[model samples]
Target: MFKFTLKRFGYMLLTLFIASSITFMLIHAMPGDPLAVAARKLPEQIKANYYAKYGLNKPLLTQYGLFVKNAVKGDLGQSLASPGRDITETIMKHAPISARIGGQGLILGVTIGILLGIVAAFKRGKWPDYLVMFIAIVGISVPSFVVASLLQFFFTVKLTWLPTTGWGEFKHTILPTIALSLSPIATYARYMRANCLDVIGQDYIITAKAKGVSNVSLVFKHVIRNAILPAITLLGPQVAGIFTGSFVVESIFSIPGLGQYFVSAITDRDYTMIMGQSIFVSALFIVALFLVDIIYGLVDPRIRVSSGKR
Candidate 1:
């Protein structure tokens, strides 16, 4: 187990480094100048001094090396647009904003999705099954932005029951949460339902039924337990995905989240903010994939044993 964990951790580190490097190169490759962005906000003399002070005149390779070094030492440099604040601090402030919405939305959406899927699969061809599948289709079809707008229109504008934007109260999160979580929920449901139906046909299930287990208990103990294993495998990857997808949801709903900062960082050409956000996002994914690897053991011991075998 320890060996497996170490290997996964190593892989995650490598992946994160590659991702950050790509982001840095892509941002550097864009036409125009990072210094020019500062020049527009600062006087020519001030801009020249700023560029020299920060070594902006250095080669791109040098800048990339310095970036990796500074990042390792927890120095994200200074913000060009939003001066006088540490980029790390600026990003941390927005973490909770995004985390709040994504976390709750994940919980609510996953719960509903798994339940609907299991029910639909177990009762295949029935009215309830068809209805659940239909809703999953609708959830799959509608894009998050469109769903967000429609939700705002109906719940906030027409009914005036929920806030259209912001992160002050629970009401404010209603529309954004629903919009962000819909696709994943639908995705999980379809996958879970298909997997569950397959599990029901396995030899073990046939033996359990032949042994005269009650239907209710069979559904819970045997069926659900086996069916949910695959979903557990997906949890870690999905958590990282949730954070990334929240970028759009946050923009539409005007919620003050990390996603908002990410967009603003790009538009404002705040290199510090961009780097900080990029690193943090990369870290989230690395940690999530690591956790997912460990979770594989908890979900099914055979995975743990197989990893040990190598």
Candidate 2:
């Protein structure tokens, strides 16, 4: 297990390096210059000074090398969009907001999805199954942005139950959390239902039943354990998704989160901010995947055995 973890960690580092390199190169390759965008109306001399100050005057290769070096030291440099702000600091400040909303959304979605899926699987062809499936389909079919809008309109605009936008009190979190949760809830429900069905039909489940195991014991001890394994795999990516924040959801709701910064960084041609966010998000995803792999070993001994052999 230790060796397997080390191997996965190495792979994660390699993945981050490649992903960061690609992002750096692509942003530099884009047509518009950050300096040009920042100093559209400023004189050429001032622009030159700004370029020198930010190392924008340096060759692309030199900049890339410097960025990688500093990144290794945990310095992501300054944000071009927000002058005087460190990119790392900016991300740190905003990420918590995204994490809060996204975490709630994930928890809510996962809990509801698993329960509904269990009901559907247990009931099989009953009306309850049909209703759960229908809701899941609707959740999957609808986009998050649309869900955000509808939620805002109904809960905030019409009912005045929640604030329309901005993050502050607990009331502000409700709409956005629900909006963000919809797709995930739907996805989890479908996946859970399928996994539960497959687990139920397995020979072990039949054996348990034949042995006169209680229904609750059969489910809680065996069915849920096996059925939920796949969902554990999904959690890594889901955590990454939540931490990175949703651009559309943040934008529509006017939440001051990483997603808002990410969008603005692109539009304003904030090179450092863009690169910083990209690398940060990529690292999150890689780390999440790595953790998921470790979890697989813990959840199923077969995985640990295979990993050790490899």
Candidate 3:
């Protein structure tokens, strides 16, 4: 297990390096100068000095080397969009808001989705199954922003049950969380339903049924236990994505989170902010994937044993 973990950690580092390199190159390749906003009105000489100050005047390779070197030292540099603001510090400030919404959304979505899936599987060919599928289909078809709009219209505009937008209280969280959850709910439902049906038809399941195992045990100890693995696999990136923030949901609801910063960074061409956020998210994603691998092994010992041999 230790060897397996060490191997995965090494792979994570390699993946993060590649991702950061690609992001750095792409950000530099983007049309328009990173200094355009900051240097637009400055004299030519002053602009040149400004460029030098941010090291934007350097060659791409040298810039990349400096970025990597600074990043390794935990200095992601200042925001070109908002001068004097450290990119790392900026992310740290707003990450909690995104995390809170995302964590709630994921929990609500996955739990309900798995339940709907199990119901759909067990009640196959019945109205209950059809109803669950219909809901899942709607969730799948509608985008989160649109859902956010509808939720706002009904809950805030019409019923006055919730605020239209803002980020102070718990009420502000509900609409965004629900909007974000819809897609995952649909995804987990479809995958879990399929997995459950496949598990149900397996030879072990048949034998257990023949031996008069209770339906409850058949569903819980056998069916759900096996069927949930796919959902667990899907969970890792979703966890990472929370930190990246929900760009649309945050915008629609006026929540001040990391997503808001990212969107503005792109719009303003803040190179450091963009690259820092991207690298941070990539690292988070890699870490989450690593944890998923560990959890995957724990959930199914066979995977660990097979991987150990490899």
Candidate 1, poorest ten consecutive residues by summed lDDT = 30-39
> In model 3, what lDDT does residue 176 have?
94
Per-candidate Cα RMSD to the true structure, in Å, reads 2.1, 1.6, 1.5
The TM-score of candidate 3 is: 0.95
Full ranking by TM-score: 3, 2, 1
* Candidate 1 local lDDT, residue 99: 82
List the candidates' TM-scores in order.
Answer: 0.92, 0.95, 0.95
Candidate 3 versus truth, CA RMSD in Å, comes to 1.5
Tens digits of lDDT, candidate 2, 91-142: 8899888888898999999999999899899999999999999989999899
Q: Number of clashes in every candidate structure? A: 0, 0, 0
The worst-scoring run of ten residues by lDDT in candidate 2 lies at 31-40
Give the least accurate 10-residue stretch of model 3, judged by summed lDDT: 239-248
Error of 3 at 254 (Å): 0.7
